[model samples]
Target: MELQQMRYVVAVAETNSFTRAAERCMVVQSALSHQIARLERELGARLFERTSRRVRLTPAGAAFLPAARQCLDAAERAAAEVAAAVGEVRGRLNVGLIPTVAAVDIPSALRDFRRAYPNVRIGLRVGASEELVEQVREGAVEVAFLGLPTTSRPHGVAAHELAHDRLVAVVAPGHPLAGETAVDLHRLSFEVFVDLPAGTAGRVQSDLAFSAAGLSRDVAFEVTNADFLARLVGQGLGIAMLPAAYVRQLSGVTTIEVTDAPARVEYVIWSRAGRTPAATAFLALLDVPAT
Candidate 1:
C-alpha cells in the first residue's frame, strides 16, 4: 500500500470520521475514501467499520494504527534531517505544559526561540503533567514542560530537569497551623485537605508521602488549578500542600514547611524517536544536555 494511504488510515482513526480526516489531510473526500478502500483490498482486511452515524476502527485497524503512525513519524524525521543538513529550522512545534510548572519563564524563552527561527510555527497545549507526558508519547505534542517526582524516571521518554523546589503547607492566615514554622503532615491528617486531582505529578508526590508516613488525609476538595486550590486554602476551606513557588506570594495564605517533603522537580520531556528542528531549537534555548 502507498504511504499516503497509510496516512489516510491514521487520520481517519484519529478523527473517527472520513470527512473530517479528509479536511485535516487537505484531500477531497472521494479520493481519500478511494485510497483507503484500495489499501484494504490490497491487505485483504477491513480497516474500519463505517456507518453513517460514526466510523470505528476494526480489530485489524486497531492493530495497524500504531505502526502506521510510526511510519509517518519516520518519514517526517527523515525530512527534518534533510532540512537540518541545510541549516534550516522551519516547522510546527506542538508543546504541552502544566500550568503550575509554566511558572518557569517559558514566554521569554519562546520569544527568543521565535526570533531565531521566524519560520517556525508554535502551538501550546496546557494540561496536567501526567496528561502532557501521554500527549508527547502519542505524537499529539512534540515536547512538554512537566512536574516530575524526584525518585522516578519516566519510561520511554527523555527528560531534562529544569529546577527543584520543596512542597509546603498552605493555610489561611487565621488557621490553627498558620503560625507554625513547619507542619508535620500527620498532624493535618484529620483536617480537610485541598488537593490536586489524581494523576497529576503534585498529587502523586503528596499521596506517596502521606502513604509512606502511614497518614490518611481527608481530601475534601480536588482541583487541577494550583491558584484555585490556594484560594480554597485562603478561605479556610482546607489546607493544601503545593510547590513553594506557586503559593509563596498569594495574599491571605501562610506557607509553612512540610517536614522532609519530597522536592517537586520540573522537567521538559520529549520523545527520543525523532527531534523536529523547532524542538531542537527550543531545547537549545533551555540548555538541554545531549542525551
Candidate 2:
C-alpha cells in the first residue's frame, strides 16, 4: 500500500476518530477515510471496527499497526540520512536520562543542541538507568545518560564514562545524625531510611553497599522520584543516600559524607551498531569520542 495510506491508517488508529485523524493529517475527513478503505480493500482485511459510537482497531488492524509504524519510521530515517549526506542534520533525537542526572546539565545541553541544529526535533524521556539502557538498545532512545554502581558497567552498548562519585547520607535538620560531619554505613544502619524503589540502579548502589558490609537496614519509604525522597528525609520520615552532586541541588536536607558509601559512575550510552545524524551531532556537542 502507499505510504500516504499507511500514514492515514496510523493517524486514524491513534486518534480513534476519522474526523480527528483528518484534522491531525491536515486533510478532509472523507479523503482520509477513503484512503484507509482503499488500503483495507487491497489488503483484503477490514482494519477497523467502526460503529456509530466509536471506532476500534480490528484484529487485522492490530496486527498491521506495528509494521506500519516501522515503515513510517524507516521512511523518516531515510530522508534524514539524505539530508545528513548533504551536511544537514535534520531528524528526531530521542534522549533518555535518570531523574538524578547531574554529570551534564540536560536543559542547557538541549538548548545548545537546538541552537546548533534547529531543524532536528528533540524528545526526552525520564526513567531509571536500567530502563533507559534498554530503550537505547531497542532504538526507542537514540542517546541516554545513566548512573550505575561502580561494580557494574553498561553492557551491550557504546558507553563513555562521564564522572564518578560516592553517595552521601541525607537527614532532616533535627535528626540525631544531622550534626555529624561524616558517617559510615554501620552508623547509618541503625536508623530508618527512605530510598528509591527496590531493584533500581539508584537503590542497588545503597543496597549493595550495606549487603557488602554485612549490614541490614530498614528502608521505610520507597519513592520513584529523588526529590520526593529528599522531602521525606526532610520531614524526618527516614534518612536517604543519594549522589553528592544531586544532594547539593535539594534544600531542607542535611548532607553528611558517607565514609563507606557506594560509588556510582555516570555514563552516556548509545547504540554500538550505529548512531543517527542527530545523535551524532548531540554526542559531538558533549565531546563524546566516536566509537
Instruction: Give the top-scoring candidate (lDDT).
Output: 2
Q: Candidate 2: TM-score?
A: 0.94
lDDT (10s digit) by residue, model 2, range 1-291: 999999999998999999999999999999998999999999999999999999999999999998998898789899999999999999899999998999999999999999999999999999999999998998889999999999899998999999998899999999999899998999999999999999999999999999999999999899998888889999999999999988889999999998888999999999987999999999999999998
* CA lDDT for candidate 2: 0.94
lDDT of 1 at 277: 78
Q: In model 1, what is the error at residue 103, expressed in angstroms?
A: 6.3
- TM-score attained by model 1: 0.80
lDDT of each: 0.85, 0.94
lDDT for each residue of candidate 1 in 247-281, tens digit (9 for 90 to 100): 65577799889887767788889987766877878
Model 1, position 238: C-alpha lDDT score: 98
Q: After superposition, how far is residue 30 of candidate 2 from its true place, in Å?
A: 2.9
